[model samples]
Target: MNAITHNTVPTYQRISVKPLAVHIGAEISGVDLSRPLASEEIAEIRAALLQWKVIFFRDQHLSHAQHVAFGKQFGDLTLGHPVFGYEPGHPEVYSVGRDRFKSRFDGARLVRPWTGWHTDVTAAINPPAASILRGVVIPPYGGDTQWTNLVAAYHGLSPALRAFVDTLQGEHKFTPPEGNKARQEFVSKVAATPLISHHPLVRVHPETGEKALYVSPSFLKNIVGLHPRESEQLLALLFEHVVRPEYTVRFKWEEGSLAFWDNRSTAHLAPVDIYDTEFERQLYRITLVGDVPVGPDGKPSVSIEGEPVAAHSVE
Candidate 1:
C-alpha cells in the first residue's frame, strides 16, 4: 500500500480521516454516529466522503433507527431497494446476507463469479447519490467487500478512449442471473417490476463536475448504440480496467463497522468468499436520494420502464 504523503493534509477539523489507499478509501474517527451530528460535523463528513469515494467507521454499534438517523443527516433517504422489499419497520434498511432460497434450491448456494460487482441500484432513473451500510452479524473471517474509484478509473483510460466513451450511453435493468432460475420468487419479483434506464457511459458528477465511468456489471446490459459484439468487447475491456488492483481498497468487516460511499463515483464488489461457508453474515444499508445523472454533454438519463426513485418519507 502506498503511504499517505505529507502534502495530503486532513480536510476536516471535527473528524480525523486516515486514507486507506492512494485513491479511494478512508478510515474516519472522532465522532459518534448514534447521536445527532453538529452542522460542522455533517459538512465535514460530506467533504470527506466526496474526497475519499468511501469512508469507513469502526466500532459504531448503531441500532436500525440510529442508522437511519445518521443517513438523514446527509440527505433524504430512499427505499432499501427499487424492487426488493425493505427490512420490516425500517423502510430504508436493505438487509444483505445469505439468501435462504438460493441455498434451499441447491445443495450449495452457488452464484455467477461476476454477479456481486455492482453499484447500489443503477436500474433506477436516479440511482442513489450515496449509501451507508452497517455491519450486523459478521463471520470470523473472509467476506471482505472491495470498492473501486470510478473517477480514477476514468482518468486512467487513454485520452482517445475517454473521449469516445464520453459520447456513449448504456442501458441498465435488473435481470435475474442464470443461477437465480431455481428461485421462482426472485425471478417473479424482477419480472413484475422491471426498471430500465439509458444512462451516459461517462457521467459528470453533479456536485464536483468530474467525469466517472459509470459501469455496473450487474445492472448495465449494453452500450446503447453499439452492436452486440462490439458492446460486449468494449464493456469487457472497461470492466477489467476499472477494477485494476491499484484503484481499489478492500475492507474486512467487524460487527460494529460501517461504510459510507458516494454511489455516483464508485463500484463495489460484495463478498464472494463467504458463500457455502458455515459462517453467517448480515448487514443493513440505506441510500440517499440522487438526482438524474447528467453526461458530459449535459443530457440527463432517460427512464424507459420505471418511475424515478422517490425519497422515503420517515414517520
Candidate 2:
C-alpha cells in the first residue's frame, strides 16, 4: 500500500510537484541531481511515480554515474539492455545519440528509430519496472517524447472487453526498428537473440494494485489464444486506443532534463521527426529491474529466449 504524505506535516516535505498533464505526467522541482538523495526524498519520488505514471525534471543535469545513482535509490538496476550494448566500463548506462549510431553503422541508410510506443524490455520475463533518462544533447526543434497511461487505457475499455482481455495473454518480440532489416543498429549491436515472452494482457501493478493495459506497438506480436485474424483485430483496436490524446502527455526535451517513468504502467514513444537531418539528439538511460508481471488471473509471466533479471546492489 502507498504511504500517504500529509501537507500539514512538514517533516516529509523536500520536493515540489508541477504537473505536466492532468492524467500522467509531472515535473519535479527542488532536487539537486549532482548529489545523493535523502531517504525522505526518495520516498516522495516513489510516491509521485505512483500518483503520476511518469515524472520529469528540468535543468538537473546529470552525469552517467549520477543517473545510475538516482535509479539505484528506487531498486536494483539492470544492464543497459538485454541485447543492446552500453557505454564501455559502465554497463548500466545505455548511450543514445546520433553520432554513436552513425559510428556503429558507418555506411548504412539510417532513419529515425522510433515510430511507436513501448515499455523498456517487455520481451524478457522481467521487463524493467522503471527507467531514468537524462538528455545530454538536445536538438533545436522537433525532438520530443510522449508517454501514455495504460492504467487509464484499460479503464477506458468496455466492461465486456475488459473481462474478455483479462483472461488473455500476449507475445512481445524483440525486433529491430523498421526500414532497415539486418543493417539496423540494434540488430547488429549483439548476436541476434530471439527474445520473446508472454505477458498477461492486463497486468496488475505490483506497487499500486492498478490493472494496466500491458500492450505496445513495438514489441507485441499477437494474442495467445485468439485466431490470427482475431488477434490482429484485437491488437489493432487496443493499440489505437492506448495512445489517445486523453491518456497521454508529451515532453519537450532540453539538455540536462531528465524523465523518470514507471514502465509497468506506461508506454512511451521516441521522436521520429528529426530523421534525415543535421539535427542530433542524445540521451542516457538507466533501467531498474522488476518482478514478472502478473495478470488479473494471478499468473506470472515466463520467458523463452533469456534469463529473468535477478536483484543486485551496486554503487
Candidate 3:
C-alpha cells in the first residue's frame, strides 16, 4: 500500500479508474494501504484487478507485516517463495534486492536470455492468482516494471490462430542456466524441481471468464502436439504477439509505491538495466494462492510433478 489522498469521485463500483494504458493498467487513487481496508474497498480493488489486469498505488510505505496483512484481504498468501528462502522471520514476505533477489527464481543466477517476462510460479500446476509488490527502495532513473495484458493478446490473434492455440498444451519447467556458479546449490535447495508441468496455451480466467494467452519465453518449452521445430516456430510467433507494446503498461516505482496485479491475466518483467546497479531497488511481495488454470474447452491443468497447492489460513 502507498500513501495518497482519497478524494476522487465515485465511478466503477465506487473507486474511479485512471487508466495507465488503454488495455492493461490503471492508477487506483482511493484507498490507503496503511489502514485496515473496508470490505467495500477490497471488493472494489478486486474488481478493478479483474477489469484492468494491474493497478498501482502511491506512498503506502508498509512494513513486511503490513504488506502481508493487506494481501490477506483478497486471499490466502503463499509462502514467501516455494523454493527460495526469503525473509526468514516473515515467511510471507519475499524481499528482493540486487545482491539477493527474493523472487521464486532468485538464487539461480540464471539470467534469462529473453526479458524474463513471465507469470509468477507457472511451474506449479496452479500458479498464484495475484501478487502485491511494495517498493522499499527505488532507483532514480530505471528499474521500472512492465506488464502485458494476456487477455488482450489472446483476443488479438486471428480466429484461426486462436482456435489453433486453444487446442494446444505446452510444457513448462525450471532449469538453472548452464553456467550458474551456484547451480548445484540451486539444485540442492530445489531438489524437487526441474519440475515439468503442462498447461493450456490459452487459459480461462476463473473470476472474469476472460481468456488469456499463457505461454512465455521464460518457462514454456514447446507445444504438446507439434514437432520440435513446429512447436518452436509457433511458440516464437505467439511470444512475439503476447509482448506487443500496445498491449502493455509500464510503472515507475518510487519509495512507498505499490503494485497489485492479477497474475491470472498478465506477464511481468523487471527491468534488465536494474541488475548490478549501485543504486538499491528493494521491494517486498506477497502472493495470493491460485487455482489450477482451465482452458477454453474447460479442461483443468494437470500436474506432472506435484500436487495442487493446498490452501492456507489468510490470517
RMSD per prediction, one decimal? 4.9, 4.0, 4.7
Among these predictions, the greatest lDDT belongs to: 1
Ten contiguous residues with the weakest lDDT in model 3: 1-10
Model 2 Cα lDDT, one tens digit per residue, 110-138: 33222468988898888888888999889
Candidate 2 structure lDDT: 0.81
lDDT of each: 0.86, 0.81, 0.79
- Per residue, candidate 1 scores C-alpha lDDT tens digits across 1-315 of 011111232557899999999999999999999999997788788888888999999999999999999998788888888788799988989988665346324333335434557887899898999989999999999989999999999999999999999999999998654344436666677677778999999999877778999999878889999999999999888888888899999999999999999999999998767865989999999998888899998899999998888888766
Model 3: per-residue Cα lDDT over 200-222, one tens digit each? 99998876778999986677888
TM-scores of the candidates in the order shown:
0.92, 0.89, 0.89
Structure candidate 2, residue pairs in collision: none
Query: Clashing residue pairs in candidate 1, if any?
Result: none
Best-to-worst order by TM-score is: 1, 3, 2
- Model 2 stretches with alpha carbons more than 4 Å out: 1-12, 99-115, 177-180, 184-192, 311-315
